[model samples]
Target: MDEFEKSSIEGRVIELADSSRREVEQEANEAKAEQQRYIAELLKNSSKTPIVVSAVLTSDHQSIRPDVLQKYLDATILQASSFSQLCEQADLLNVKLIQHGMAENVSQSLDSRGILRLPVIKRHYPSLVYESQAISGELAVIDVISRLNILPIKRFTAKTGTNIGNGEGDGYLQFQLRNMFGGGEQLKLDITKGTKTHSSYLLDYGQPVTPWWMLNSMLFKNSRQFGNNNSIDMLIRGFRTSLRSGFQEAGAINHELFYEAEWRTSKLLSLHASDTLLFQAGDDIKSSLGHTLAVDRRNNPIAPTSGSFLKITNELALGKYWKSQVEFSQNNSWLKDDFIGSCCTFRSGYIANLNSSKKTVNTYDKFHNGGANDIRSFQIMGLGPKDLYDSIGGDAFISYGVSLFSRLPIKKWSHSNFRLHWFFNGGKLINHNNAPLKSVVTQLANQHSTSVGFGILLRHQVARFELNFTLPLTVHSGDAMRKGFQYGIGVSFL
Candidate 1:
């Protein structure tokens, strides 16, 4: 062989070996990087995958006892697919949690084994410092919440707002305090004071709707002015105070049940005349234990365009008199073209006095129908019964109100909150005492009051105002009928 050929072959063989070695080293490095990524992802959901390790909950300065949390969580935490799944389990398991107690996903921290440390998961809970208070059972966590500094025991707040209406304009001041402690248990106190210019029994019409002739005439004081028409105005002032406490009964996805104790007292500070006209009134002190169930799936509470709302409250007053009241209301709506929202509200209530107390249920509380907040066809409390010039109210009452809303005809105001609604109302109030059974059932139903009306529903962010004109189709003899136009302005609708 020639010397030049032999030298060239050896150099080519060396170059080939170097090239192969470089390729092998690069492949090994890439494989290692890929394996680390796989290991990291596997750690993220190790509890859900083939790995089945019991969740070890840990905390910082917060003293969280795993033994207590696991008692309520049972074995669900072991099977949770991810941190989010674990949180879902915690929410449903009747455990106490701080305001922003769960936010661990953002911190991609790791332990010695490159696995997510349970302590880092718990660090997401920033506000709470947990302590064990109960001596026995899983419910001991509730005791921990009582001593939690994250939630305060009491807070006082006051609000002053303009209370405007079709016939009355007034300002109100209300003070409230709500205390939250110990596993959703709560205590609330409320005080309200307001003044209004009102008509007979706080139902009928008042100025400035009252014509000038009726106000200036000498007969204004003596004529049936207050009765025939609610033109004679009277200044009224009242103060009310209420206290409520509730124990956590149960909580589900969108519903909650509260077992509550309620005490309420109201005093009429001043009134115009207490003679034969404003006859039936006295002090009332009512104490009640009740269960209130609220299920809210509404898309919007301000102006619900869709979804549903249900509230059922049943109370029993236990004392010298055993009086019970049950109230149920359902609100539902549908939006057409995502803008035209139509809604219907159905509410029915019943009250009965079981004992023979001089201060019967009728003496203090009655079903007052027909108002912007209720039927909207007549004046407040003007639909059912009348005791001479006053609406004395009734024991058992049922009302059905259905309303339909659509865009205004004007193009410029088509999407504005100032819109139009048509409604139909039908209901009856029954006083079972001194009344025929047939009348309470079917006979009065023949005279069941019904009215159809149209109104302007002016909606704002905080309130709703309405102007209505109603025509009664079926009016009973005693019903304070509104023959022509009726005006109502309030925050809610029938």
Candidate 2:
């Protein structure tokens, strides 16, 4: 009985071995077929055959004329070594077309693929060089065809919002012209008006001179009214030209070199305006060249959960006035279960009348500390020396702030663009009095105002809003401090 069982098991084992052998043979055949396909593709792309583009065709589009399309193709598809390279050039041509506003969508036509595979007699393609007998043959000459669809080259947009932080309303109308002169040049016009910003008109032009750089020019006129403690109105008309690195926020550093010429006029809106301000009130002309360098790696510019940002600026005006500013902020999140995080920021600036003939820097060029957009619990332009009701602007200033934030506890509100934040802020602004910059910084560090607050933060695509209930922890005499609920809004926040 044992011998009989052994024979049966041997038979079962033989049958299983046969099945495994067949499976192995099938896989080997499949792999061989795949290898052949890869070799064919490699050979097809490795060919050094010269291919002449016989003709180029594009889909009919109303916005772009046929001659314009032909001109672009003539410039880009002038030469290609192989069909693969031809396809690559064609793809790049599509990109160029889209960039120049000739079309938004450009794709190789299926007919081009068909033509590549078509069997042709020598008479049909007398100048064409092709290896038709080879398993991996390449075509030498071919007509390229593509489909292109047009896109509008102009746009108009309007934006309006209530300034919950400043108790005001603001709105703007924007008009944009794209690809002006068929060269990816753009012109934009903005008309803006607000309660605090009385009115502004801007005409901006930009050209992408290269992939990495942009040239920009702006003509602008602005009128602003400071209604609170400053009680002053300012008007500015300016023209600016700049070469800037492309706008990108994802851990990229950007730079700008600019020249600006402006006419500035200041008028006192209140009869009781300070004598310091009164002396500064008048029309002045300024011409300056400046450079700005910035590094932004923040997850969100409006309300970052992580990463950091930094910016530095320097300017020389009329060759006798100099200014420099540095701003830095960082955000971090330690809790994994919730969006609990902290943000810290520091800002400082210096301006000097390098001209020995002048005694003071222009107020328009000086730096001011404290605002809804800057250090909290203090009025706009509220820090530093005071003359009457005016915060008589400082020639140098430094400010810093820290905040801790968390998402709302409610599960439904976890993904909302709202969070609770507690903050501590402090800063000082002072005239340098011909002192060394290090000594001035030391003075700022020793003598500063501070405030602590808790606030609800609302993040928006256009701006961030904060409503904080604040208390001044340390006060400086003559500083304008806000003691209760304060609403703040603008692009940058501490």
Candidate 3:
């Protein structure tokens, strides 16, 4: 009786185990089939048709990254179910992206025949890092494409000249050129020239601001003109005029020929170098052709010259936020006849969000009396005349500083924003020789000066203009000995 019961129990247990295994296998098979069907549906509907995306960026008086908004558009287009769905998807994405008073303007423009014109995407965003990077990347891409097509832009320059001492008033000219590829390469050129003159007096005391005033202006003589791309830039200038009594006698003939070429390894970095040779012969050639060497801290020539200069410049950006540059020159009049004066500058800045910013700066000191052409400004200006042998003192200097800049818009003028910046700059001018005892005492007691200043920057974007005035709050005791109020209209670059 016991053997028979045990066998029955074992058979029942085996039956239950087999049934459980079968149920699990069936469920796994069903799940696999469902996944296969879903993937098949995605593949069957996939088409080779190109996807077009449009985006509009707007901020309610706030700045955002346009590239980030553009990325949202790209993601929607890539995952869209259909062309119409893609457009609708873009519209929906815009609504989800508004932040901090920003807005987007998106719409479709259509033609009379119902054909799509261009989709318009406008956004109001203050300049942001990502947007800047995106734009820089896009520009790099365009430059690459242009190079591949042999239509790379070669050079851009704007220059103005005036006859200061005695001449036909003031003459001005502006020119620009862009190179593109056609059957052969083509160059687009714009040239302008003009002249004018005016005079005024201060009303307070009826004092004359100037004994006489005159201006000659030059407007673009021609627009939309094209020339051979490979042709060298040729410029010819000549003027003849007489000076009245009380004015210095001046007459001049001058000409210049310049050539430039550019090469780019990537978007973030580029190299541009140009060579310009000029020649002039006249009674008062000071205004036409002359050279001077830069003086070192000790008033020695780093770059001495009076006639011609040969310059080479290299610009490199290590990444999106860092950049450096090196410049070399020869035969510059500012260089001392025996010394070569060269300079190097490195600058970098990064955005730590839309609000915070950081920057680094370093500049090499100038080597005085170190070039082939050694001419001194003090002598030229009639302050002192010393030969190179007698005026042989100079040394280089180094400056390192950091700055933090932030955007804070004014409520009254929302469109014209402002930036608040605080910077600490310190550097030294290395003298060729140690200071004399008296000079050292003078410097320690307030004979030499180091300056520190801080001020606000009023920036108007529409006009691309900036007005900055810094007040030196901290100055060495020596600085006060020679210091007067220092004021300027723009940044040092201008």
Tens digits of per-residue lDDT for model 3, 340-432: 222222221111111113311111111222110111111101111112212211222323333333444455543334444343333222232
lDDT of 2 at 228: 47
Tell me each candidate's TM-score: 0.53, 0.69, 0.25
By lDDT, the better pick of 2 and 3 is 2
Tens digit of per-residue lDDT, candidate 1, span 281-379: 333344455545655555555676766666666666665333333333344444554456667666666665556445455333556777667765666
Q: Clash totals for all models, in order? A: 0, 0, 64
Model 3 poorest ten-residue lDDT run: 140-149
For each candidate, C-alpha RMSD in Å? 18.5, 12.8, 28.3
Which residue pairs clash within candidate 1? none
Of the candidates shown, which would achieve the greatest TM-score relative to the real structure? 2
Question: Candidate 3 at 280: error in angstroms?
Answer: 18
TM-score of candidate 3 relative to the true fold: 0.25
Error of 3 at 161 (Å): 11
**Model 1, position 326: C-alpha lDDT score:** 36
Backbone clashes in candidate 1 total 0
